[model samples]
Target: MSDTVEGPFFHGTKADLQVGDLLTAGFRSNYRPEIVMNHVYFTALRDGAGLAAELAPGDAAPRVYVVEPTGAFEDDPNVTDRKFPGNPTRSYRSREPLRVVGEVLDWTRLTPEALQGWRDRLAALRAEDRDEIIN
Candidate 1:
């Protein structure tokens, strides 16, 4: 991974948060609720966060918030070099808290069909027992 990454970073979630709220680690994993996450994840890409928001489990609407890291962060090892060749995802995680700065209202939303496709893919991964998260 690179030594550092620059960002006007973003985090996606179903949780309603106000500006200045601190997003910290130790929350349950969105992908696997059984595990408590050791790091808080975010992305430099706006739509990437949007996708995460869409996939987040809950009836509430997805939200993408502009954020600032309060401490050092690094590339998300789960996808950085393992899934993609490099950090094409611009994804990162931090053990420290990320402060919400603002929200993105104009982000692209997935179509119903596209959203179903992702759900189907996730189900398939679960069936194959391949939904392993590095954290």
Candidate 2:
């Protein structure tokens, strides 16, 4: 993406994710966000719904924050807050430790149709798995 720090993450609203979804969050820094990738589906934990995403590689696990309809919105840790009714603006906070990854190819600029395709692809991956959580 034009503005980003990490990779392999998806960006969207709660409607974009399902229960038992799990995937790495592509971030910018150890402090705030750079770019968000919400096109892919995940094996969601009982973790989040309003823009659900997991921390990157090194942070601890089980850290999540809920961004609801009335929640406050602010600049991403690295950028400014964006207000768009078409876009969800719920704040997500996690306390886990994870390692940040490089951003994907223009993750923030994908068209809705492209995102939908990625969503479908991710869903297909999950469907093929059947056994999601670690055994």
Candidate 3:
């Protein structure tokens, strides 16, 4: 059995995420409590589509936050993977079931600029992941 934890866990006030929803999270900085880094996320996907289609009865949706950090985001030790540069986009599964308190916007229906940003962010994340695996 593998002991590896697949994703970072986050705690929030409610579970309000659905697949394809773009979520923004404000991660508090460890160096400065007053500072918060905002990270966007495209909800968990299944077979290249939103995970919502994969849900079955009696199954509670997994609370996963896929980090989409921008170039401006500081590689804060407390908020992201220290091994990765800019801590590029990654999945952050919740440690315990917690409520979410953020906005969940559909990425497919968003304005052009926002959609482009999402695409760019995902591409960057894939590039970073590739580099990490290669090194």
Candidate 4:
């Protein structure tokens, strides 16, 4: 949403994304960070809980990264909307490849209120049958 980038940047903390979660991330090239991207969700191959430390150790652990048949939601926007570029609906996915920027959300834990709010959102995603990977 910042002027620096034209679209929204996905953000997830280390704790949010666990091993095997499905999610997407957008990466910005410019330090200023304003760009369009196509987001794709992948099955996390490794646990991201201590990703920073694992990467720092410099071993052949393959580190933290997602894997599997990558795909996107059919209805997901490939471009940023003028009104809410970074809003979840418009910005969650994009036309260009994005980096894994955040934790893959756990859809199963949706609270009643959260589920109610995102009912339409969940439908819009056109999620694949593989969503079961989260559980």
Estimate the TM-score for candidate 3: 0.27
Encode model 2's per-residue lDDT on 1-135: one tens digit a residue: 113222222233322333334334353432124336432222112222211333222334323322121122222331124433322332233322222222222222345576467557656755665556443
Point to the candidate with the largest TM-score: 1
Which is superior by TM-score, 1 or 2?
1
Tell me the number of clashing residue pairs for each predicted model.
0, 29, 5, 10
User: All models: lDDT?
Assistant: 0.90, 0.31, 0.35, 0.33
Model 2, position 29, has a per-residue lDDT of: 35
Every model's TM-score: 0.90, 0.23, 0.27, 0.24
In model 3, where do residues sit more than 4 Å from their true spots?
Answer: 1-94, 99-109
Summarize candidate 1's per-residue lDDT along 60-88 as a digit string, tens digits. 99999999999888889888778876789
TM-score of 2: 0.23
- Residue 106 CA error for candidate 2 (Å)? 9.9
Q: Could you tell me how far off, in angstroms, the CA of residue 131 lies in candidate 4 after the best superposition?
A: 27
Better of 1 and 3 by lDDT: 1
Model 4, span 1-135: residue lDDT tens: 122223222322222344445544464321113443335422222222222212222224322333332333322333335443543342233333434433333322334575345544434443532365455
What lDDT tens digits, residue by residue, belong to model 3 across residues 4-42?
A: 323222222124464344334475522223556454222
Number of the candidate with higher TM-score, 3 or 4:
3
